[model samples]
Target: MTTSNGSSGLFISFEGIDGSGKSTQARMLAQALEQDGRDVVLTREPGGSPGAEEIRALVLQGDPDRWSAETELLLFTAARRDHLERTIRPALAAGKVVICDRFADSTRMYQGLSRGDLRAKVDALHELMIGQEPDVTLLFDMDPAAGLARAKSRATVEERFEDFGVGLQEKMRAGFLALSQEFAARFEVINAARGIEDIAADVLARIKARLP
Candidate 1:
């Protein structure tokens, strides 16, 4: 099931704390939609387009303290700008469903939840730079302890974010749930703890109900 953002096609985003399986679900959703004969573009952030990908590596690799919260905020916002311009907007214009693994919400949860209540800054940047929101955002809600365990099992440089540990994962989950309330019009709180097949099926059913 896909939700149209009142544009040419649907813009769907999967959001959750790391290891919530949103990434895998994003891939599955894309494949399922394609099998259904729908034109779909599956992508992700803090990278999606070429330029944004470069930024992605910069932000995701290296020491955990590589960049300050404010600096990381700028980098993420820039990446999102490029992604929207080069990938998401065009796909939508072509009338193809665009499923992003993560989007601006990650920035909000990661940076906004950081010290000093930086959410306002994140929101300001989003409002000023990337003004578009997804048609439907599937929030993969689950236990932080389980999610952190899953994240720790990965052997990738992208560990920068996930390495923050389980405590933060709990906070991130809460933040995502709060975001669902803020953008209730387009947010679907999916139980990520369920079996992958069951979660995917639920997501499909929900999205199909919103397809134009």
Candidate 2:
């Protein structure tokens, strides 16, 4: 899967509501791919590059209402741009499969719809700044309530979004499902309401089918 930048690399992003097990699946996939002799760069959004990591602390560690939706959108875009330039693009150019825990789609749902109707703005900014999309987006689908419970159990400092409660999780799940339809060609939906190994096996199979 060659990216838009002409890099002959497969860019896969894992996306789902908080605590949907997408992160765990992403790590497992990276390891599996590495064991297969593929050069894999496992990373995450809002914190891939050094600059992006700094921005991540600001956006993720503060109060839920620390920044308004608009402000948060700008912050996320900045972080993504830095991540693309410093980490993602370079790895792709070197012909590495980059497995990202989250990407633009998260911002599209979190900042675009979670707070208000700013999806258009998000799209516009993305086009103007970071124009690259993953070659494949794996959407881990599961019950929002269950996912929230899992997320809250983590007790991580990045609980700002989780603090918004189940309502937001429900909305994010719906928006992500809609987004899968919107970008169905590159979107692969997986049932996340299962054991880790089972889900990882399903993910690896799908990814293998897509590999060039």
Candidate 3:
């Protein structure tokens, strides 16, 4: 990943549909790494830094139709800018593994699908704005319907994206898998249908393979 104040540490991103258990796996990975005596920073997109957190509430709280896809992209990019500047870059420079819950892939799928066909625009904007990518990405691949059911069981105000229902989630799952093909060098597809410990073990193995 390229940056003005670039980091020497590995940048890992966890990606999947809302209920793919990526978040849990990310947390588990972080804990496992720390247990292995490595420095790790656990963070999430659209809300990693204070400014980004503010942006997060604004973009995620209201109706799913609250902002146009273009507007939402702008907001998400703004938040990501803040996160990279204040949180991610520093951690990387300090030789800490930065585990991000969601990265640009989320934008590629969510906005690209929600507001009609915006994949080209998403790619263009990411290259223009956020040119870097994770050193390794763990994609929790699973059935969208199962993931949606897991997501629906959660209690939170951030249901804007979740409200898209199973159909949209199916589309999103496909989008993420397609992305794995595009960036096959960095993506490790994990089976999320299994138990948490098993998934976490696979993630740790993939990460350990990359950690010098």
Candidate 4:
């Protein structure tokens, strides 16, 4: 997890299955960095900026049959563009530590696993929109079955992806692992099958070691 400019400012993203504890860890990491006197901007994909939030609702709440795989990919990219332009990129340029709960990787994994051809289009759009990548990405590696169980136990309502069958979730988990390997230098896989504090501690240690 090396940084190009020695981490005076950093952009970190969290990726994982539905219940992989990314949001919790992302918040904890951001708070820890803030305590260390680093300016931190905590945000999430699909619902960061105002425009993106609207798209998020449509994507997560609207009828899945209304959207094709290609449409789903485009909608995710649309939200991402808004998020990057309005929230992420600005914070990074201002020398703030940007910790995003999810980013482009989620789209790649979900859409890649579900829609084969759409994956390539999403990748191309990602390159066009988010020209600069995250300095570090923490991947919460956990079994899809366990993650789904945890997610269902925690949530009263299921989002569109949450409603996806176990098989798709398993495939998405595999996609994440494969993507992590492909970007080994920038992506760190964290064992997320532990207590929250334990996971947070490990994540903190990883970030501290990577940051200048």
Candidate 5:
């Protein structure tokens, strides 16, 4: 793993498809670290800050056909910019371990795989908006169909990603795997087919080994 500069605590991100158990694992990891006496903060993308939450509702509920790829990318970046400035940066600066449910990686995979030609533009925007990347990223790998099934079983209402067809979900999964290969040190792909406690334990072990 690459060494991070200064005294700022580690920034970790949990990423995956809708039903890959990212939220559950992120919380478990944070709790375990806190129990171990490490300061930790848990937050989620597109809804961490109040401003970002409002923007999240707009982006998620709006008609996808009505919004262009460029527009979608911009909206997501706007929320991320707010989240970074208001929530993530402050917590990390105080030497608190920040465990994010999702980050810029989700946007890269979803927008890049689903919208091809717009990928470069999104990448450029990401570079401009999010200056600091997470120290470690845990990607929960699972079959798209199984993920959708699990998500549906737990969800009270369907979101845009949940409404998407199987083909797009498969493409998104492939995109995440390709990204993990590209950034091997920063990205750790965990098999999420196991029970929640077992997956959380594996994630905790990785985080503990990586902590400075």
Candidate 6:
């Protein structure tokens, strides 16, 4: 179930609040695995594939209130479906490590808990449309205030979520921690408020231990 249609490749997903350094760690993990002679396919949700990438612009670059919570959920699910079809599944089928920056967990947090109580809806959509879960999900936990500061400093068009402010980040951080407990088997909570190299080393080791 974790490897997509029973494929042999490892599926690893990085999850955290905005600016928590999960993206950097995901990339570094991919590079480290490749350096170790492993076939690695590093991708991300919302914009992993061509179709999803299009949806990404529509959802991520607009005003925070541009789309209703339910509408945003549908859009994200559509993008994830495309991503799975065009990027994740094929790579896993080819026996390559699929490292994703974010996955359904983010949706489960952002849309499921952010605006309102939509976790049930998010879960229903996921079970019906996208059934696969990552073999391991590294949760980069950090202070919400610090993370929000780092996120706003990025100055990227994807600031829609960041624009929600620190209050949302605080709520999101708690939501993500709860998720880690809910999906404890695949979730590894990492303190992300540290040096990049140190965090990368820890992530690499944790992932290697879970690799088949």
On lDDT, the candidate that comes out on top is: 2
lDDT of 3 at 95: 82
Reference-based lDDT, residue 139, model 6: 96
lDDT of 4: 0.83
lDDT by residue (tens digit), candidate 5, 30-97: 88999999999899987799999988887777444646667778889999999999988888778888
lDDT of 4 by residue, 1-212 (tens): 33553335788999999888898999999899999999999998888999999898877775546577778888888898989889987776677888988888888887755656567777788888766678889999998999988887775443677777678778888889998989998999999999999999999999988775
lDDT of 1 by residue, 4-111 (tens): 555679999899988899999989988998999999999999899999999999999988889989999999999999999999999988789999998988888998
Which parts of model 2 have CA positions greater than 4 angstroms off?
Answer: 1-5
**Residue pairs whose backbone atoms clash in candidate 6:** none
Candidate 5: which stretches are off by over 4 Å? 1-6
What is model 4's C-alpha RMSD?
2.1
Tens digit of per-residue lDDT, candidate 6, span 75-167: 999999999999998988888899999999999999999877999999999999999999899999999999999989989989999999999
Candidate 1's C-alpha runs over 4 A off are 1-6
- The residue ranges of model 6 lying beyond 4 angstroms of the native Cα positions read 1-5
**All models: lDDT?**
0.89, 0.94, 0.87, 0.83, 0.84, 0.92
Model 6 TM-score relative to the real fold? 0.97
Could you estimate the TM-score for every candidate? 0.96, 0.98, 0.95, 0.93, 0.94, 0.97
Clashes of 1: 3
Candidates sorted on TM-score, descending: 2, 6, 1, 3, 5, 4
Query: Of models 4 and 6, which has the larger lDDT?
Result: 6
Please list all clashing residue pairs in model 5, or write none if there are none. none
Q: What TM value does model 3 have? A: 0.95
